[model samples]
Target: MTPTQIGLVGLVALFVLLALRMPVGLTMMGVGLVGFAALSGWGPALAILGREPFVIASNYELIVIPLFVLMGNFATVSGMSRDLYGAAYAWFGHWRGGLASATITACAGFAALSGSSVAAAVTMGRVALPEMRRYQYDPRLATGCIAAGGTLGILIPPSTGFVLYAILTEESIGRLFLAGVVPGLLLTALFIVAIYLQTRLYPELGPAGAPTPWRDRLRVTGQASSMIGIVVLTIGGIYAGLFTPTEAAGIGAFLAFCLAVARGRLAWSGISSLMLRSIRTTGFVFLILIGAHIFNPFMARTHIPSDLAELLVGLDLPRLAVLGIVLAAYMILGTFLEGFAMLVLTLPIVHPLILALDFDPVWFGVVMVIVLEMGLISPPVGVNVFVVKGIAEDVPMRQIFAGILPFWLAMAVGLLLLIAFPGIALFLPNTMIR
Candidate 1:
């Protein structure tokens, strides 16, 4: 069979396995192993498999994944999320729809520490949903805010998705982390605006509650000093060249652990639990990385990516038009695929095309992240939505979806702004790196 036919068949098998609810890492590995054997015989396939694992496992940069995951686990177990929510609530809770806004803000702050969307959604759901419900905020709006806002995890610094993208594309982890800052803040701002407008347009949706005193608000902010310190030590250390990305992860993990222990939240049992969870997640991610390494070389040998790039360039489409089409494809893929899964599946094809087009990789990375962010809020298989639902089973799923609608629109606006001004993503990376 032609290599094209083999690649196509492998992809079909992948989707079939995914539909059967097979773990993503297993599906990719299964199809990739078989495809490699078919194309180059079992002996060569085994040789590739033998070497691939060590090659992937030994990379210095990959160390950041487990460290960052450990940091997030420690932060969650330490109860920093609750403090973040309280501070945001104190500052914003008096305004109409202020509770919902606080939820989004809290999610953003929590995202700084826990860079997984599911983690952010579930944690914020438990912390903020009860408060929103207590204040008679619309259940849909309250739950929806947590679900959509949680997606900030991937766009914010320390994000696993950003880390994975940097690894795959051979981009600087520090620069990629820097690239996300503006876009992440812009999306967060957009979410806040959406919440404000929603409540203003229909004040009945989010009733105003008693306002916190200025002194109390200041006190709440002061209590959040630890979080500020963590952010400074972790992100600031990287940008200032005080630490490599791996070292930054180590600093983050150590600091989170120390903070948790200082707060009396890190018992031996809790530490054991956090370690177990981080190991499980790290194992899964590493397995998927191994599978992609096996599959990517085979795909490159097939010339499919090159062929696609040639076809695209030959079409003579405007560069912006081509970019639009790619963004649309990511939006559609986001609905059904996990963010990491989508990245692994498409980057082989998309990255080559993007490089051939001479577009800025940093800008492209930010665009991809924003589009995936939309997927986190999309319907049917939106992972963040499911996370919130898991935490607040009493809230109807329809209302959760409805509540995210405006935020989704705001994300769309943010996407357009980034596309029009790639400078937003590039400015920090260029200015700081130089």
Candidate 2:
């Protein structure tokens, strides 16, 4: 078969495996190895399978993944997520719909530590849901806030999404992290506004809480100081050129471990659990990366990216129009595909197109992450929504989906703002010291 036919058949097989509930990493690996062997030779395919995994796994840069995952696991165990929620609640709980707003605020703070959306949602849901319920907030609004807020994990600094994007596209990790800052904050603010408007129009959705005194608010914020400090030092260190991203991850993980021990939350058993969890998650990420690497060569041989780019450029559409179409495709895929799966599947094709258009890679990474965030809340495969539902089992699934609609629209608005003013994603990256 011709190279195009081989690539096409491999993709079809990959999709079939995905539909059969096969792990994405294995599916991609299987299809890629077969396609490569068909196009090149089994010997070359075997050579890649032997060397690629080690090359991808041993790269010092990828150490950031497990270390950051460890940091997040430690933070979860130490109850920093609860502290964040309490502080946000202290600040926002008194307003109408304040609890929901507070949930978003807490999610943003926690996102700085935890790079995984499901982790952010599950942790915040535990801390915020009970409080929202106690305050008589509408279940839909409460749950919606958690689902939407959790997506900040991908857009905030220390984000795994950005890490993966940086690795895949050969962009600077520091630049991508910096790029996400303003956009992450923008999305968080948009989510807060959505909550306020939702409550304003229907005050019954989120009842106000008893106001906390200033002293009490200060004390709650103080309780979260360790977590806040770690975030500042870790991301700040990278921005200031004091640490590489990998070094920052190590420092962050070490400090998180220290914080957990200091808080008396780190028993030997708990440490073991954190290690195991981080290792497992790291293995999963590494597998996905390996699969993408294997598939990338097969794709390169097929000339699909060039063909697609040529086709796109030949259309003579405005650059902005082309970008809109790409983003729209992501939004649709986000509704059905897992975020990482979508990234591994599309980045080889999309990233080249992005460069062909002369768009900034860092800016595109931020935009891609934001679109992925939207997918985390989109229906059918809305991972964050399902996470919230697991925590709020008494709430109907449909209600959780309904509740996320406003926040979803908020994400849409955030996307448009970033598009119109690319500065939102570029300002920090552009200011980078190097």
lDDT for each residue of candidate 1 in 317-342, tens digit (9 for 90 to 100): 99988888898999898888888888
Candidate 2 residue-wise lDDT, 198-236, digit = tens: 988999999888999999999999999999999999988
Q: Alpha carbon lDDT of residue 85, candidate 2?
A: 86
Candidate 2: worst 10 consecutive residues by lDDT? Answer: 425-434
lDDT agreement of model 1 with the native: 0.86
Give candidate 2 regions above 4 Å deviation.
none
Best-fitting candidate, scored by TM-score: 2
Could you tell me the lDDT of residue 394 within candidate 2? 96
The TM-score that candidate 1 achieves is 0.98
Pairs that collide in candidate 2 are none
* Candidate 2 similarity to native, TM-score: 0.99
TM-score of each: 0.98, 0.99
lDDT (0-100) at residue 75 of candidate 1? Answer: 88
Candidate 2 lDDT (Cα, 0 to 1): 0.91
